[model samples]
Target: MSEEELNARHAEKMKKKKAARDKILATKTIEKGLLIVHTGKGKGKSTAAFGLVFRALGNGLKVGVVQFVKGKWETGERKILEHFPEQVTMTAMGDGFTWETQDRQRDIEAAKAAWERAKAMIMDEEHQMVLLDEMNIVLRYDYLDIADVIEFLKTKPADKHVIVTGRNAKDELIELADLVTEMEMVKHPFRAGVKAQKGIEF
Candidate 1:
């Protein structure tokens, strides 16, 4: 085809695409809090949730974060977010991973304590966004009662958004979530014997 013909054809196709996108956009008028789940074996689950925290803060929104399984080490995000103490509430509640703790009872206790903090954040009207980091792992191990968690989630205020991140999310939670993203692992450096580098893994 000639260059002029190609340009005209592309313009017509783009015009149609824009019209369809606009139509769809026009139909989306509903607005409410979302129950967002980020789970899977891949990396970046908590990273993605923290990105939303930054976006929310940028919009003058208050965010509450409770770390369930990553409390042993210091993270760069935590340090930066601490600077915005007025808008961000971050609590590192876990004692570390299950393997590191090596005690089922200790893990359970930690999970329970973390859940108490998370529940308070969920119910606090001051927080617009609450990130429950690594919550899925606790759920997978049955640390907290799923039914109780569901009840509180369903009763949260209409304008409070909740983000739960970790791997191996339960099916019940997935069913109740408004948006669920399962990150599929295509490749990872850990499998190649590469230890986690600073500012990337944390």
Candidate 2:
């Protein structure tokens, strides 16, 4: 085909694509709070949730974060979010991972304490977005009852957004979420003998 013919054909395809995209966009008119879930074996679940925290802050919204695990280590995101005290409320409640703590009862107690803070944040009308960081891990270990969590989520304000992140998310939670993203593991640096790097992993 001639170059002129190729250009014309490309333009026609793009025009059709644009029209289809616009039509789909027009159909999405519902606006309400979203229950977003990020779960899978792959990384970036909590990272993705934190990205939304920045988005909420940028939009002048207040956010509440309850870290159910990884409470011993200091993360870069936590340091940054702490600077925005007026917009962000963070509570790191876990002592550490279950294996590290080596006490089932201790883990359960920690989880219960964290859930109280999370519920408080959820009930607070001032927070526009709430992040339950690594909540799936606790749920997987049965630290808290899934049914109770779902009931609490259902009671949240209509305009409040909630994000739950961790691996092995429960099926019940996924069913209730408005948006669910499962990060499939394609490849990881740990397999290649790379330790968790600063800023990137922590």
Candidate 3:
């Protein structure tokens, strides 16, 4: 074919592709949000959870965040959430980190309290989104009651959306969710003996 004819054919293909994409986009549903669970041993579960919080905030949704096993240590997400006190309701369990907990019973109590707090926030019809940060781990560790948690979540208003983030989420929780995302660790800076960087992996 001549060069001009080839260019014309390319332009035609592009136009057809664009038109097809536009048609598909128009039919897409405005999602009613979801009951989402993020689980796996990957490093970014917490970050991914908060990323959704920021998205909800941008869309003018009220969000509730309850961190189950980590508090008293400064992290980028906490600082950002702190700035949006009105839009975001965050309650840290004050357990710091599981490994740092000197008393197991105390740790469990702290986590249980946070779980209860999260349940109440999620049950409230006014709360649009609930980010149960690391609550899955608490459930896995038996620090919180899975049955109670599930009941509370299931009873929430239909328009409410919940996001659970942690490593090792139970199969029951996964089954309960409308959407599930597993973040597998293919590679991580920590594996290379490098410390976690601020903002990116804090």
Best by lDDT: 2
lDDT by residue (tens digit), candidate 2, 1-202: 9999999999999999999999999999988989999999987898899999988898899999999986534468878887788999888875687888899998899999999999998888889999999999999999999999999898888888999999999999999999999998899999999987787787
Q: What pairs collide in candidate 3? A: none
TM-scores for every predicted model: 0.95, 0.94, 0.85
Instruction: Judge candidate 1 at residue 19 and give its lDDT.
Output: 100
lDDT of each: 0.89, 0.90, 0.82
Report how far off residue 34 is in candidate 2 (Å): 0.5
Error of 3 at 20 (Å): 5.4
TM-score of 1: 0.95
lDDT of 1 by residue, 66-130 (tens): 98887534478878797788999888765686888889998898889989998899898889999
Between prediction 1 and prediction 3, the one with superior lDDT is 1
Flag the better candidate by TM-score, 2 or 3: 2
Residue-wise lDDT of candidate 3 within 1-202, one digit each (tens)? 9999999999999999999999999998677658899988877677777888999888888999887867544477777777777898878897575788778888888887887798788778778999888888788888877887787777777788889998899988998899898899898777679875666666
